[model samples]
Target chain A: MSCNLTEKVSLLVDGELSPVETRAIERHLLTCIECQQARADFLNLRQQISAYTPALNTQVQQRALASVLAKQGRAATRASAQAATPEAGRRPARIFGVPAMPFAIGMLITAAVALIVTSFVFYIVFQQAERDRQQATNTQANSSREQTATVNQPPNTNNDNSKANTFGASDEAANGKQSVDQSQQQRARGPVNSESENRQTFAANARRVRSKRPASSGTALARNAGINAPLDLHVPELLPPHEASAPRYITINATAPVAAPVRPVDAGTLAARHVEQAGLLLRAFRNARTVEQDAAADLSYEKRRARQLLYQNIVLRREAANEGNVQLASLLDSLEPILIDIANLPDQPHADDVRAIRERIGRKNLVALLEVNSTALARAYE
Target chain B: MASEDAEFTMLFQEFYPSLCRFLECLLGGRASVAQDLAQESFLQLHRTVWGTIPVGEARFWLYRVARNLALNEFRRGETRHRLFDRVVEALRPRTQTPEEEYETQERQELVLSMLKGLPEDQRTALLLREQEQLSYREIAEVLDVSESKVKTDIFRARTALRERWAQRVRAIGASVR
Candidate 1:
């Protein structure tokens, strides 16, 4: 039977034993023949196992190493190629860490939204413009009808009746009628007064007539005419030169020059006139500092004129807004407050108040805007 | 990454032939299968755990993976039959040879037969210890067993191989007579 320490001899062959254990196994091997034989047998077994497969030749070792390295190179190349595929392949580019497709989609959506909003705003603006245009056309048509009615009216003989009947016509037509009636009454008196005296009397009567008329009478008359009937005969002198020769009580055809009244002022023409007048007032007010000596007299006239223009401004502004003339409406809207300030100024305004008004006009650049809009409106009407 | 690859290449060149030899002996002297398994083990190491594993542990890791692969080959049963057929073929005599070459071939045949007779674990332990020269601890690590088990397996394998070799020699002596 083999010695029990033969297992220790196997460990000993592998040098797995401690030095003390090695010395002990060596001593035992010197004394025991069976352990010595087992040790030799174990050594022989290790030698046989080592020799069982011959060591590969250098050529074979090199070939094996080359094969492995070559495979590793190929595997590495494949891995790198895979890593590079995202940039080189079908993967989308990124912008600011966001994918290009989604970013482009976002941009397109934003553009679509902007387009919709812009189109909606334009629609609203155009709708307003159309409404204003229609209103202005209606105003022109009504004015044309009143002028046509006046042109068609028979000349009245009674002076008082003619005065009362012509009340509903435009202020220009009423003034023209009163002057013509007074001359006819003078003629009915059989030219008793001397011509120069009559001329002085007529001049005094014309001045008295103008002074008696309220500043808003023209606007009131127009408004009344829009609401009332045709009242009296039109003055021959008030008609255009071509229509002046036309017989009275003639049929007013569609092609008749009815719209060419004593003064052809539609809402657009009126707005342009208002803008021009307000620009002149603002310019005078803005430069009032240069003529401080005549400031009181000028302030009275300017304030009175501002009050009159303020009334016209409100009416024209409403008409402009109704016509969807946003540019004109907005200009008048801004001008209203300035006109109010000027109209409300004291007859003898303080220099500081005048300076403040001047500063406001300059700051708003109202003069330049008024000039530009005035030219645009005049061109539009012309 | 380049340095890691260089290190892996160095480790491969150092361990490939030894791994092939260990596998050849473990698989009962199937040289081609051993070589293939060795290459496959290295490939697996590079693919799965090259940089992740600690340095100097590749040798143990490779043997463990190769041992598992060889075990799978054994479980196939067809490989076992083929291995048996190969061992038998090594035993069959061919043309005349010099006495030294004949004896060397005879000894190799004897060793292969003795190895085939041992249990799988004992055979692996003995081959690792003798052919690969792994210590008992390393054999335990490669086999994933206790160091004491590796020692016992190696000792048992040696005892069994010695007995079988004696029996084969006696039988050969009788045939020669």
Candidate 2:
């Protein structure tokens, strides 16, 4: 067992084993000479270690004691500090620290709340701005429409004005109160037969005055011969014989009251005057279109075309801007159905020829328009 | 100082030295670094009790903490401390003859150096048994090993130590003769 058994003996000296195991190991070592020697050497080392009793300095021990007492006191203080913490499901109280965990959490919560509040405010403002843009677009459209209507139409009658007033009030009530009503009403009158007949009468009176010219050198030749006499004239077809004949009766009847009768003009003079008079009637008839035609040409070609395109552009842009605004889109949608109705209507007289033709005439008048200009067609009967 | 820190300082002063001495033995006489490691162990204890670390399972927590710190020190390699101890031994009061002291010091160093060669589990078991005086159950708690395994590791460690010592003794004797 010599020095070989020293490590085992040290473990034995430490009393690491149960009494039974210790006894068994001890019994084996007693008879063995080398083991006995190793046991003595281990005993010598143990004795030396045990003999060196270095005392712990008193101050060091006291310091350690004080540290332990201080730790206990701090632990008690910590316990109280912990008791102040709010439990689960509780709102935290303000506490002091440089970026304390609880304070950081509270700040994070407050930041999140503030962000949500700001976002909500922005959303409301965005909605309001969209509404304002839509309202402005509607106002511009309405003004342009009124301008177009006034330029194209005659003075409105009492009945038409009353009807427009009633319609405006009713339309306002049906929709959310209108900022402006952009639609215009154009009155439609029947064929205009009476007006054309009045113009015919006026043209006849003009012919009568032109035939009454005192210089009748051509008139005297025309009165001397029968209807078979050949007289070259600019307008022989228009002067029914009676219009030229009436002036002779007037000259004969005036002879009783007159001291000296005015001398008659020559045949050439009579012929030229009648031709000039006929040309005047034709010019009047050709130029006699109602004010509405002038206005329709002005508005439809210049103002309405530009204005309509602008309105269309506004509607398209607004539709894009109102992508998610249901109210705005619906408002635009309600107005879209009426655009064709408004556009196809006439500028005056309450009749919408384009609309009536589109509905009733269809292709019936398409081929007819090739030969008939609108102004010519309107003036044809007159 | 804050009231809490002042209290903590008093507690630190009380526990530090003994804990250091205990760690010195646990880490196989790594005495020079023992104080810092022991202080670190107490800081963990303070943190745990104060709810900086969650509290619960706190009693005997310091012993476990000190043991872990010692093991961590071993793992970290105490080369500077070992060199420092060698220097201190040259200056400090010593009761043993220079020859005996040298031999004893060499043997202790030999044991510490050899500890690296052993399986980590076996070395840990031996240290807990010899230095910490931990019961089998307590050792089991710290190592998270079965009690029987702890016993076996200690036995294996002792056998390895004995074989190593015998070989060293034989080599020394042969060289001397």
Candidate 3:
């Protein structure tokens, strides 16, 4: 027969019972042969199971431990490397040998600079536009003043108008000479008849001439015309009618063409225009040598133009230097020697002399330089 | 950290052998698989919960993890066919005399067959109690079952194995006759 205490034999062998419970189980086991046999079987089973598998050999244990440690070391190294460089597995893209971050920063800086330059250009353009608008207003006002002066003139001055209009259409240099003679004659006659009106007309004419040229040159031109004489005022009543009419006619006609409004040219625009013209002249001069046998006759016009350009170049170079335009000033300085060489050429320049100038032009690469600066300055100021 | 590693190493050295023996019986006498699962259990403990386990619970924890691994291997069914090969490998003679080695192998085969005959849970509980010498409560902890269940399982496993042992002995006597 099976004993109920038989199951407790398993727990008892495992020491799961308390001391009192162990005592009771032991007391029961003493008399119950079946319980006693169950306990023996459980104890025997433990011994059998324990001996079923052998312990790993010493060498195997050490090797297993070493493998574990080695693996752990490698894992630790990999983890630390990952921590040190987070992007170790995959690096970021680059542009033109520059890394992404710095390239992006450079692009941002360039965009900002371009934005500032664009705004500055807009500001200059607006200022130039405003100046043009104001100049138009002043031109209209000056034209009204001239019409008023013409309408308020004496009856004898009508005949003088016809004479003045004729003079206005004549050669500018001859008109300037006739003005000088008329001013001297008026000074000899002394002041008479509406001196204020004559003085007003004379002052207006002087201002008109001054507006068309540079300050120094305009002043010298005014002196050459004798319009600078303060006492040479027209006095119609103090003179013969013909003599009185002559001063007003000469003054009005001599200054008429000069009175039309001329747009003020800044040094930059002037230099750009000069470079453009010089580039054309030099290119044509170079092409003419190849295209024509009588290049000397064809070059006469260029030589005369070169002399005029040379004078303008000296003045412009000084202005550019004073304006602190080193690039333009340097270009003009290089151009000056070439202009002098062309201007000093004989009426029929020798083939050797022409070749020397052409060689110098090519050696300096002045044509390309001039073309680039010309377009650059025109784009900058336009 | 060094002290922690030292402690883990000490734990590994102390328990690795017993754990392997426990898993050997659990996995039907597969010694190599038992050693692998045992080492894997220790590695898992180190990786996941080394410093976090309570002091005495690491042994229970290791057995639990190893038991789970062995369970997974059982589910794969790959080990079933390899069971005979592994039994043969385990019984392979080494340093013992031929007569002693034969007797040892015979006894080991008998014990392994009886142990394998028990249900999986009962076998695991019984092995944890008998082989590891764990208390019923410790077996409960390792198997994550109630202590009463552990007690019942071990008792049932013992009764079953005793019956099988008696039958085998009687059969041997009959064959001798």
Candidate 4:
């Protein structure tokens, strides 16, 4: 018992012993000098410690209590002040310093709803603006193009219709310049800048037309007919003995004409070369009148070639008259004016103009003259 | 019928002076540091909301925080020792003869130096058991160890301190000869 009590003396001094153990230790201590000495030593050392361990003075203890109270008071005031103020966009309510997801979700939904409403308002406004624009377009459509042009044109121009036709030339240039081909059509439908860029642009267009157009064409008779080019008529260069090209400068007063140069046709055969040239002219006229709508531009190029042939055919037609080929001469007479009209036709000709030219050829029997005369001319080569 | 604040204030009134005295004793008589540690311990209690805590054991909680903070201060080295030394000097016994006062102070220094020299767990166990009058279970609560560990530490601290005290006295006697 003393052995057990001896080791537990610290616990005994600390009042840490169980009641049963304390009783056992205390009972043993009454008779056990060794246990008694152990108990005395533990108490004496503990008392010595207690004797020296410092205690805070009354003043220091009060100061600490006051400081704690002051801190609590300041916290209470700050929390109250925060509660009193209204928040404009306060942080969503929190629980234990974590934001409440439901409140955040509500704010997100509210923001989404507001954005959708604003977009809806903008959509309505844009749709109304579009309707107004379409209405204005219909109102303008009620007026004739002439009246609309009258309203849009500058004042004091009597020949404005003619001037718009003149401006069509420049419109072509500007149309040529627009990046999108569709933009050219839109700009053409509006008032144009008629002033600058015509001469160089027209020359450039002439060069382009020359490049793509089939080889030879007569210069168009219309002034500023940029659509036309110089003609290569392929005239046969033959004439009667007394004619200007007969290699003699003979005067009418000299009854005897100088001896005529030998006939260049190799057989003294003026009828044959005239017939061949006439056949070529007739073929040109036929090609120009070939009215395929999809190939109207090629047909237009053919017409320019025919106009050139007609200019050459005048000399050949005169030779045919000298031969007294009445059918061919009459055909040539009818074909000349038609060739000029076809040549001078707008770069994009009306279908009616082509149809009319076809009708005139049908009336004049030009196709029959070509067949008959070309057959007769081939005998010279045979 | 007490509000949370009133309950806390009641606890403070009950423990604040005792807590100051406890800190002073643990810190080797730095009265100012004792006041600070006591206040900081209560502040920690106040900062932790009342609901999550086991209010039934607020005393243990306060002492635990105060002891941890005081251990940190102790680990700060020379500063705490210097403070303790100045305090010991200030609280010098004025009524005693010069030799008697010297002997008292020398003994006090030897005991304090021994306590400080012991391992922290043993020192804390011995101090909580002896100076705070804490039970082994309560000392375990403050130090976050098992009650058995607390008992072992206290026994070890006491035995070592006693053995070293005897050794120190014998050395002093040898010197006197």
Model 3: CAPRI class: incorrect
TM-score for each model: 0.42, 0.33, 0.44, 0.41
Tens digits of lDDT, candidate 3, B78-102: 5545665556365443658989878
What is the C-alpha local distance difference test score of candidate 3? 0.64
Q: Which stretches of candidate 4 lie over 4 Å from their true place?
A: A1-5, A18-20, A23-34, A53-55, A80-382, B1-10, B28-31, B49-56, B75-108
Across A160-210, the per-residue lDDT of candidate 2 in tens digits comes to: 111111111111121112111111211111111233432332323222322
TM-score values for chain B across all models: 0.83, 0.65, 0.89, 0.71
What's the TM-score of candidate 3 when only chain A is evaluated?
A: 0.32
Model-by-model DockQ, in order: 0.16, 0.01, 0.13, 0.13
Question: Which TM-score does chain B of candidate 3 obtain?
Answer: 0.89
With candidate 4 superimposed using the best TM-score fit, by how many Å does residue A56's alpha carbon deviate from the native?
2.3
> Best DockQ goes to which candidate?
1
Per-candidate local distance difference test: 0.64, 0.41, 0.64, 0.54
* Residue A331 error, candidate 3, Å: 99
Locate the minimum summed-lDDT window of 10 residues in model 1 chain A: A250-259
Task: Please tell me the TM-score of chain A for candidate 2.
Answer: 0.19
Following a full C-alpha superposition, what root-mean-square deviation does model 4 have from the true structure? 51.0
lDDT of 4 by residue, B1-177 (tens): 124454465456556756765676567656667767889999778755443464436777888888888888888853644666467446432657989878876766666777776787887777767765666877888788899898888888877777777788799899999
| Better model by lDDT: candidate 3 vs candidate 4 | 3
- For residues A1-382, what per-residue lDDT tens digits would candidate 1 score against the true structure? 5578988887888899999999999999999998888888888888887876433433444466568667866755654554456663565454335443432344467577867997997687666666554444444433443432112222343222122112244434455456545543443333212435444435444444434554222212222122322223323243455654343331111122222121223556667767766776675556333244556755665676678889999988887786666877899999999999999987667778888888888888998798678757766876
